[model samples]
Target: MPSEPAIASAPHLNIVPASVTPLPDAKPRRALKVCLLGYRSAPYGGGQGIYLKYLSKALVEAGHQVDVISGQPYPHLDPRVNLIKMPGMNLFETGLTSIRPHHLTSLTNIYEWMGKLTGAFSEPYCFGRRVLKYLKKHGRHYDIIHDNQCLSYGMLDIQKQGFPLVTTIHHPITSDLKIALSAAKSWTERLLIRRWHSFLIMQRKVARELHHVVTVSERSRMDIADAFDIQPAGISVVLNGIDTYEFRPLPNVIKNPNRVMAAVSSDQPLKGMRYLLEAVAAVVPKYPDLELLLVGTPKEDGESGKLIRELGLAKHIRAVSGISTEDLVRYYNEASVVVVPSIYEGFGLPAGEAMACGTALISTDGGALPEVVGDAAIQVPIRNSKAIAEVLETLLASPAWRDELAAAGRKRIEELFCWTRAAQQMTDYYWQVIQRENG
Candidate 1:
């Protein structure tokens, strides 16, 4: 016979409204789970890869969990962020013009093999299938997915799965195709270039359909809108940021007497390395000791290499690849000036990085180089070798102008291109999308 304890009466609570006021120092909330997607993200050289790495690092630093889902040439991300590797056939690895039977395993792989065999690049579409498969299994883990310019059909499936999707198109690939086609010597070469860039059709479609779109620059936003036939209102411009800590001038390094530095990747025609080489040739007679230091590997047996040999610049031009960021920054510090001979750029990260390191900049008026460099850099016309030569010679001859531009470049970067500012702007944009979706 256990004695029952007397039951206490339940307490009643009343809800009341309080005066609503914004807290002056309250921190903004960020996404708890974020996924960034890319087709190819190699941090060693490519801009997209570098974007994925820094953006993920910045997001993670801002108290958000970020994951990068990428294809071949996997991203180099901060250890805090998870990496989801979605590998493709990577036909570029084959090193041969023809695809062998071993390359065809999955249906997607088969399609890619056939496509490449016929001169049509299928990396985007095949990568889409792989991404779709990955997201089907892992999409539930993310609060939002941010695509890094890999606009593909697979994204549609992820969007349909009730997840918020945002895309960052650094620039349009159509620009690359147009530039390459314009440089093609024969109709067959032009046809091949067009076929290879056929993936633009899919990209255009995906970009138009996606609700939240981010691009690196205002110029890029307009170009993408025009290229993809999308409304400018649907796109948001978030300028890219440079890491000043990694890109700062090295005090111990002495500038090279005749060394001029330029950074570029292998695939893009808009980089304008060819024009830079021609400019180097033009200046070699006046400055016998002059040399060009390219911060990228030359494509093997490619047109670029042939041009370099044809111009007899093998001794004067040095192309180094696969170096650490610290070492690359050292090159920037040791150079007389950093040149950006791009026909077009979405945001011109190289220009920003060079300027960040307190290097004198000489850039062509490519897509957004002028916008990035402002009056801090000497601007030249795109694809004009003579202009590049004249600018280089002028800068080399005038120590006063070089020093002034160098100081201005660094100041501009400090004011406009710091990573902290970029991260804050991106965080705000992320919240805006989330609030709009919830509303």
Candidate 2:
């Protein structure tokens, strides 16, 4: 292998207040040159992709030059921001058969292939190696670099190169590992789960060494500190924002009085889909016509599928995936109630989106959920199907109560969360990091 490239020193730039310039008398903040990094940012992949998409657009709107450097399934960004594609093996999309003789020449490719073969996730680590190589050659172009939860060792290298780096740790992957282990059926399953999460070792080390670590919520700040053994005070909090304009209610969409809706990304153990299915089954005894419209698909042989068969909920559930944003908003508008049954969430995007769509919500008081929903939605205990069922019954029976909750939810989201506000807060933090690095 060739030698590592020399680290570039920080560039000189005037750091001042953010573009919004909240104060009338405040001086004009210079348009910052920003570089955002994401290891795998597909819009439908997860929250990280959504975060990258909206944040970059918002920052550009705030009068800054933003570039997104991502690997595999690059993000959908605004026209103004540049997208620097850094493709990887993408073994998830293209099976192991995609590897060829030419792939063996690159050590990063070999590492990624081997890790995937062994049931380990190697995207973050391989992405780090690629990113380090890219930035080492052109690191001086940006005033600051913000990473979206790809806590790889290469990030530490980037920081060592004298660049001002900030990382957003949405939540600790340790939380997911714990939930998966508890739900495992056998020792072999437990072992496989641990192997898949082996990259956490790199993440924990990098997180501890980084100077500026931020999280989306106070719960995540505390959890990340505990999971990585860092001090809570050292971690900063910046709540995520909802795209209120895109997710708002459409009055023309006719509501289905007997239907409820949820958006689950996958049939993962941590998503708590089984609990929601159980709740739906329990409620079916009362309302025979009750139906659930799930926005994401679940594997036919997965736990959720098996539970649906055992509980006789096959007829009551319908799932649709890969739908456009317009279709998603329309579904949200047509449902009588939206439920977020996550066992845990760093920041509950579904809950916020549901509320923003002017729909009544029922969510478990899992990590940071209450912080997002506040008094607007009905809060239930985690892993309790009976509680969820009782709440559903009460809400479905009372149209007046449902209308009241819906109004409150929309008001709360309008007052507290939005992409514009998130971008402004992030811009201020960027200036803070740059000034500290220069000093």
Most accurate candidate by TM-score = 2
Candidate 1 on 1-439: residue-level lDDT in tens?
A: 1111111111221101012222322225545688888888887757888898888888888788888888888877789999888877777875446556776657998887778678887887888788778777868777778988878887877677767788889999999988999888899888888888888888888888888898877778779889999887678766688888888878888888699999986445778988888998999989989888988878768777888889988898788898877788999988998999999999898899998888899999999777788888989999899999999998998888888888888888876766766666676666666666767
Q: What overall lDDT, based on C-alpha atoms, would model 2 receive against the true structure?
A: 0.86
Put down candidate 2 lDDT per residue, 1-439, tens digits, no spaces. 1111111111221212223364432222798999999999977778898899888998999899999999988888889999999999999889899989999799999999999999999999999999999999977889999999999999999999998999999999999999999999999999999999999999999999999988887788889989999998788766688888888989788778999999886578788888899999999999999999998887788888888889998899999987777788899989999999998999988899898898889999998888888888999999999999999999999889888888888887776777887777777778778877988
* Per-candidate RMSD, Å: 12.5, 7.9
Local distance difference test, candidate 1: 0.80
Error of 2 at 400 (Å): 1.2
lDDT of 2 at 203: 94
Report clash pairs, candidate 2.
none
lDDT for position 428 in model 2: 74
TM-score of decoy 1: 0.90
